[model samples]
Target: MKITTIGLGYIGLPTSIMFATSNHQVLGVDANANVIDTLNNGYIHIEEEGLQKLYNNALKAQNFKASLTPDYSDAFIIAVPTPNNDDAQKSCDLSYVKSAVRSILPYLQAGNLVIIESTIAPRTTEDVISPMIEATGFTIGEDIYLAHCPERVLPGNIAYELVHNPRIIGGVTEACTKAVKELYLTLVKGELIESSASEAELSKLMENTFRDVNIALANELAKIGTDLNINALKVIEMANRHPRVNLHAPGPGVGGHCLAVDPYFVAAASPHLSPLIQTARKINTSMPAFVVNSVERLMASAPNKKITVFGLTYKGNIDDTRESPAKEISLMLQHAGFDVTEYDPHANKNEIMIEQACEDSSLLLVLTDHSEFTTIPETATDRMSRAHILDTKMIVKNCGDNVKLLNLGNMHQSLNKIVQEV
Candidate 1:
């Protein structure tokens, strides 16, 4: 299979490399000349485990190449970003997807399969994407087969998930779906479920939306627990023992690219139809403000306290901060007059500017659960006045007598009793 992948970001690069290593001639198309050049030298622009190995292997095998311009290929996979617009609506900013399709339209030949791996709104393939390709006077379904096969790989684990995750392929026609499935069958180990393009689009949205809603439930419970002076974490733990009841942990809020954003796409299409989804988004969005308020209340007694925020990434282990709650919480705390410091082992780019702030803080707020923060040396802790600790993610285990620990969910019932007595 000769595969051309557009938008060489997190999703595109990995997907293209996966196919190329499988012996397919893969050409990655990106508008960034620097990214294309870097890949050509067997270097990867984005960070992911096992990606450098795959990139190097594909480059050495001469099975993979990247270009700023699109070229004709047997198949084209679109894996562009579909970020939500500013209107508080779930509309995708489809500029990149549109540009990729337009660039490839000139070279698209008959029997070429165009699979969209980008997360998009339902009917985007059949209605928006296909018409754009057909405008080039190419016959639809006969000359070019269009389908939506949404990519579900997590950022840090892209290589593993790319091959392991079950894929959903929805095509304009049954043949289109089958062809896309066969192409993935060569590389993907998981089953490829067939459906209409719209259904597959909705399915991806639904999966992420389900997570967002569940996380929102956890977030809501965390807020109520905070007010009641109860440990939300212990409560959730007790509930989970029922086997049928499983509750997600609450943090500053929902972060990461997919869960924070995808539900909006579905909500935008049918706003009146899905109130639960909309409410979940609203609750998650409000979490930063809630965290800020909690920090302010803590700061009231300890006036002008220096607060050190440990972890800036959206989640634990991964460096990505896209729509991260930790970032938002840090910013909110900063605005509220507390000096804030941040550290994430995975974040080497100094993207969040918290190193200087962390060194001089009076309080330590564990916003993210990055592994590095868990093992802070006693020597380092001694330099910071042994500041009070707020464990947002509940990553910290035992706190010494000098450090007062505050957690989103009350882990110790004694703490709740103390709060009640106070």
Candidate 2:
């Protein structure tokens, strides 16, 4: 299949490369001329595990190309970002999706499969996108096929997941479903489930919402533990020893494009019935502030206000920082009048060395669970005036006894005492 995939960000670029390397001709389209230029010049803009090499393979195969505009192709995939729109409803801004679909309309031919890989709210494929495709005077299911095929791959492991993961193809019509399925047979190795477009949209949103809710529960427990002077992490560990009780760990807050944002789509679709979902968002959103307050409380007796922040990406080992609470927390600490130095080592262009970031700092704040964060260098720790570490992600195992370490696991025991002393 000759596929024209629109929008070449994290998801779009990798997906374009995936199809291009899978024995399909792929023309990746993006509004950013720089991205198009970069991709066409034998380089990719985003970071993924093996995407650069995979893209290089696609380039070698002479099947992948990039452009600023869409062209006629056997299949068209829209993989754009649907960011949050309104404050009251928290619905998605579908302007990018709409624009991408409109751009491909000029090149749509009969039997061409149109797939939306962007995660959307329920009924968007049927009610919203179907009408836009129909505007081109091509009847869906007959002249053109449409389906909502949301990508279900982790960022770091996209190449493996895209081929192995079971894909949900939500078609506007039965013919649409079957046609889209045939298009995906080029690459997908996992089972392709057929369903209506609305189900697929809701399924994708709920997949992230379910995790958001559980994570909110864990965050709430962490808050309550501080109030009651309990070790929330130990309690969760003991509870998970049971056969069915698997609780999530609490952190500074939830981030990333999915977990922190997707639940709002469900809540916006039906706000009256989504009280739990709405509340979960609030709890997770509140966590960054909770972390800031905890920081202020612990730093009451510090010699200086200088602090070092380790990691800013949403999760570890990736440079994607969309909706990152670590960044938000860093800003919050700065707003509270603290000297802050952020060092990701992996991300932030390796801006500041660990030793430089920690120089004369009173506290070291660990956000993302980067593998490199397992042990802090003795050189960096020696530079801190009063070495104290706050591991919100709970990944730091060794900082030495010279540095006082506090995490969610043992925060409660010292929280109230710290508050009293402050």
Candidate 3:
């Protein structure tokens, strides 16, 4: 099959390479010239495990080529971003998806299968995409086909998960579903569950929404622990021993394109019945400020107010920082008149080295759970005016006895003691 994948982003680039390597001719179209040039020159612009090698193989086989515009193909896949609109509700913004669809309208021929792999709000494929494609004067099911097959893969292990993860193939018509299934079977190693486009869209949002809500529960627990002098981590550990309990770990906040953003799409689509979802968003969103308060409490009487922060990416071991809470915390700390320096080895760029970031700093804030952050260098703390380490992820272990280590659990213990003394 010949495929034209629009939007050469984290999802699009990998999907294009996957199809190209699977013995299908692929033309990857993107608005960014740098992305096209980078792909054509046998390199990748995004960070993902084993993608560059796969891209190299596709290039060697002459199956994949990057272009600035679309070409005629048997299938057209839209994997663009559907970010939140800058409104009060933060509803789904489909401008990129709509543009991608319009860009390929000029090349649509009979029997061409149109698939939207972008995560959208429910009914968007049936209501928005169908109308746009029908505007091209083609009957959707008879002359053309439309489906919403959302990508279900993690960022770091996209290549592996893309093949292994079960996919939802939601088509406009029953015939459309069958036609789309035939195309995906060639590449998808996992099972393809058939459904309507709206179901598939809502399913993807709910998958992330479920996680976000659970995380909010954990964050709320952390706040309660802070006030009540309890160890939130210990509470989670004990609760998980029960047969049916599996609570997520509390962190500074939830981030990334999916977990933090997808729930808003759901709530905006149905505001009245989504009170739990809305409350979860508010709880998670407030975590950055909560972390800032923790920092202020711990570093109140330090000789110097200089703070060194480690980790910037949303989670650990990746370079994607689309909506990371660490960035918000850093900004908040600065806005509150604290001299701060951030260092993340995994990030594309860092202004200061880990050693320099720690120099003369009174406090160290650990946000992301990178494996390298499991132990802190003793020499890094030698020059600190005050050696206090506040570890939110609970991963920093070996800072030595010279430094005062604090986790979310022990923070309240000290605060309560201070209150008793006062």
Candidate maximizing TM-score: 2
Off by over 4 Å in 3: 417-422
Sort by TM-score, best first: what order?
A: 2, 3, 1
Lowest summed lDDT window (length 10), candidate 2: 413-422
lDDT tens string, model 3, 1-422?
A: 99999999989999999999899999999999999998888899988889999999999999999999999999999999889999877899999999999999999999999999999999999999999989879988998999999999988899988888999999999989999999989889999999999999999999999999999999999999988888998999999999999999899999998999999999999999999999999999999999999888776777888999888889888888889999899999999999998888888453555678899999999988888899899888887888888888899979888988888777887667656765
Error in Å for residue 370 of model 1: 1.5
- Candidate 1 local lDDT, 1-422, one digit each (tens): 89999989878988999999999999998888999889887699876888899888898899998888878899999988888887868577778788878878888888899999888887899899989988888766677889999888777788999899999889888888887888999999988899999999999989999999999999999988877767788899999999799999887888876899899998899888989999999999998898787776665545356887788888887768888988988888878777776677676564454434445556678888876666545444554654567788888775555666778875334344545666
The lDDT values for all models are 0.82, 0.91, 0.92
Encode model 2's per-residue lDDT on 1-422: one tens digit a residue: 89999999988988888888889999999999999899889998987898999999999999999999999899999999999996887798899999999999999999999999998888999999999989879999999999999889887899999999999999999999999998788889999999999999999999999999999999999998887888889989999999999999999999998998889989999999999999999999999999999999878888999989998999988999899999999999999999999999667774877889899999999999988999998899999999889899999988877988889878766667767775
Report the alpha-carbon TM-score of model 2 versus the true structure. Answer: 0.98
> Candidate 1: lDDT over CA atoms?
0.82
Candidate with the larger TM-score of 1 and 3: 3
The local lDDT score (0 to 100) that residue 86 gets in candidate 1 is 77
Per-residue error for 178 in candidate 1, Å, reads 1.2
Worst 10 residues of 1 by lDDT: 410-419
